[model samples]
Target: MTVEVQLLGGTANQGRVHRVGNTVRRPLRPTSAAAHALLRHLEEVGFDGAPRVLGVDEAGREVLSYVPGQAVTAPPPCWGLTDEALRSVGRLVRRFHDATADFDPSPYQWSPQVPAPFGDGGIAHNDLNLDNVVFRGGTAIALIDFDLAGPGTPVWDVAAAARLWAPLRDPSDVTDVRRGRELHRLRQFVDAYGLDAEGRAAFLPALRDSHRWMRDIVREGAADGVPGFAAYWTAEAEARAERARAWFESAADEITNAVT
Candidate 1:
């Protein structure tokens, strides 16, 4: 059967993605085998939010079920910045984590593995940036772009999500309604995810570490000549990252208070 192809946007990977009927097609990466296995596990466990991998296509691209929803982009709209939206994102991430908890990752060839300060345990969707999520009715519904998924802890994964969705950032760099509500948003996320006392204690510090981790990745990707990361590095990533680091340090007390 012949199908029309539509190019996808909002991705930073150096691969072209296209939509074909009810599925998406993208060039396979070196880590594609691992990502495909992860997706397969998600399907076997009946997790509806993730895409179902359909093996390689005639053109040798990886095919995935097209999750129908709007991908939230940068400078997030007011809807994506709401307290309700923040909670929703947290819950979705928690669900994904729970589903993948027992998945044995030993057989997979995952790449760019994240170093979790807590322990090397659960597999996490390491990159939960705004653009990687799909939203509907002003709420986060599903996550996409699994190329960065790898072994890590729930706290580590949640911390990364909070860094983006709860927006643990320098106020100067934030442009949405979420600008001044970092602490509040962080608390809301913790509450929604039902983090325990110990998890709460570790959350703030984990978030700080995530900032450094992300900045390093951006710099590394740019150095490797990836256009998207290169553009961000050249634009304002350095200054923005430094300021965010300082802000996370200064707000550490407040973040702890909110979550604890």
Candidate 2:
């Protein structure tokens, strides 16, 4: 999905992101452009956990405040998915929600003209894809990609994170090789987030809805002819999604039983 590369001599992890520099970086819809800016605003206003927007670069590629660290997409086999890590992620998101509480919608805020699937509230980084998060020193520190940020519900945002970390996706999709363990991970994350009985009980089911909705939108992107999304949704994605469906079904019982 990375189309271009340039050396900006800043972040070590992502290695110089704004390569297009003052030119059309890649084929993007206008809203994508606005997202970059919105993320910048959030950073300026104390939402520093995510990438900072550095304005359009030399070639007009969006220059972002690159976060330097590791984004653990999957927990390693030897590495246990610790409660600490889950809590760190929860705290990071909580900070973001709080920071953006007073953020005004510049450039029409998140989801400008297009109606977002989620409601408006704190700038929700609806896309909590594993790769979008940055972890340093054993704690979740920063998040990137405000591309999906918009007026969305706290439940929707939390559900999105759970879908990845609780991993509402298929069990097989979990690279950690843990079968029913992710259920525990879900509990850890929810507990970290300070959710009450209502939020905890509703977590997995809400995540289920997010899972179905998120994938459908990705599929929709393919149908609508978005390049990167289309490539994914075309062939392998379909089968992968099926497996995810099965995996989630297999874990449904544990999800129902788990307590945060």
Candidate 3:
């Protein structure tokens, strides 16, 4: 019998993922079919940065090929916090966007979290949180957890990555080596991703939107009694969210200058 080893990290899937040999088993969601289709399309187009859908398990969970790499979990390892790692993430996201350029998302009902002004240019991973990215030797390799993958623009994806990876949060909240270098790192990320002038121009607004969108998701998840979200939505977390918003407003010009 194949042993089921639980995989840690990620709030939404906490206590749910298990590794059986070289496959991962995850619970099916309303959007799983669409996510699976996206994965299959990525495979069809030869995008190796995502896991391959390996069909369903006997227990009815979706099975995916195990991507062998370390995810940037809490307290983030030294390698995952380097500037090079950030750049690699930017480049990887760009590649993912390019791979989805010709995909037809019209056939799938995606997560309804996609907001306007950044409407469906292509399917985006949407949740590029640090833990979603898998890295080896400090280089980002694959993006997992496609539950939030849906209709989104390339800049939107870039902004989402920047928000989590560059982590445009308030400095008070960033206690690592990345503390004061947020905007500088954000510039490196965008440059690595090779955002065009137009994309750069739209990036700041996208960042603001991305921040609110993610905040709302976490807030809703907590309200709906999700254990991870509930645990994360403490009074301090709420205060940090407000501080992050204020920081964005005050640093808008600096952020704009950095990316431009």
Candidate 4:
């Protein structure tokens, strides 16, 4: 196969990702081994929404199946910011959670787990932001960028996904038609995920935690000078995080009432 490389663009992680043929080549990180094992497990369970982890290449980069679709990124296009799209992501995350239910993470070293409640049992995609989800024809088709995958609960994963998709943020900061539908979308997401009473009850706090967890991650990456993260940190990431926190604070009760 021709080895011509194409760089993937985004303002999140620092890794260099390239596309060659139907495969994605990414720089290996400390958590790569655990991520590989998790991908293999997902394949073993017949979950096709995640990429297949093909071992490393000659250059020492971790190779993975290139999921062919458009990745919805920051300032996502209009199609990616719809209510239907939000619900579809909810179902996709649920499927990922269910498929990972039987997998164990004790055998491999992973990135540090997110803080409590989220840091419990089960392997979560951890970072399910819109940028990590690949969509085709406006539907979520696959998940990518598993660098943050590690031990966590399904509810925690859902919260992370919701914070990005439902987008727990102030109306002024939100860029799409979803500005005023935050609570409405939260209800839609929880309903689509089929959360139980307990999960519903825990949703708000998890949402709060997820928001802060992401901020800390960005701060660390920026301090360490990890590529894209540092740029984001210097720009609007922290301010956005604070604004999101404030919005969630005011909207939490309404979200809880709707979820339960």
* Candidate whose TM-score is highest: 3
| Worst-scoring 10-residue span by lDDT in model 1 | 6-15
Per-residue lDDT tens digits for candidate 3, residues 83-171, read 99999999999999999999988888788667897976887888898999999999999999998899989999998899888879889
Error of 2 at 63 (Å): 1.0
Q: How far is candidate 2 from the true structure (C-alpha RMSD, Å)?
A: 5.5
- Per-residue error for 247 in candidate 3, Å, reads 0.4
Model 2 poorest ten-residue lDDT run: 7-16
**Candidate 2 wrong stretches, greater than 4 Å:** 1-28, 32-37, 73-83, 106-118, 234-236, 243-253
Clashes of each: 0, 14, 0, 0
Candidate with the greatest lDDT versus the true structure:
3
In candidate 1 the C-alpha lDDT for residue 84 amounts to: 89
Q: Model 1, residue 180: what's the lDDT?
A: 85
TM-score of 4: 0.94
Q: Give candidate 1's error at residue 203 in angstroms.
A: 1.2
Can you write out model 2's per-residue Cα lDDT over 1-260, one digit (the tens) per residue? Answer: 54565433211123434444323232234576567656666767866687665555445555555577766643441222456766788888888777777766655634432234446545677777766777777788898656556766566677678767765666656665445667777777776776667656665666666677767778887787766577667567788877776766776777767754
Candidate 2 has a TM-score of 0.76
How many clashing pairs in candidate 3? 0
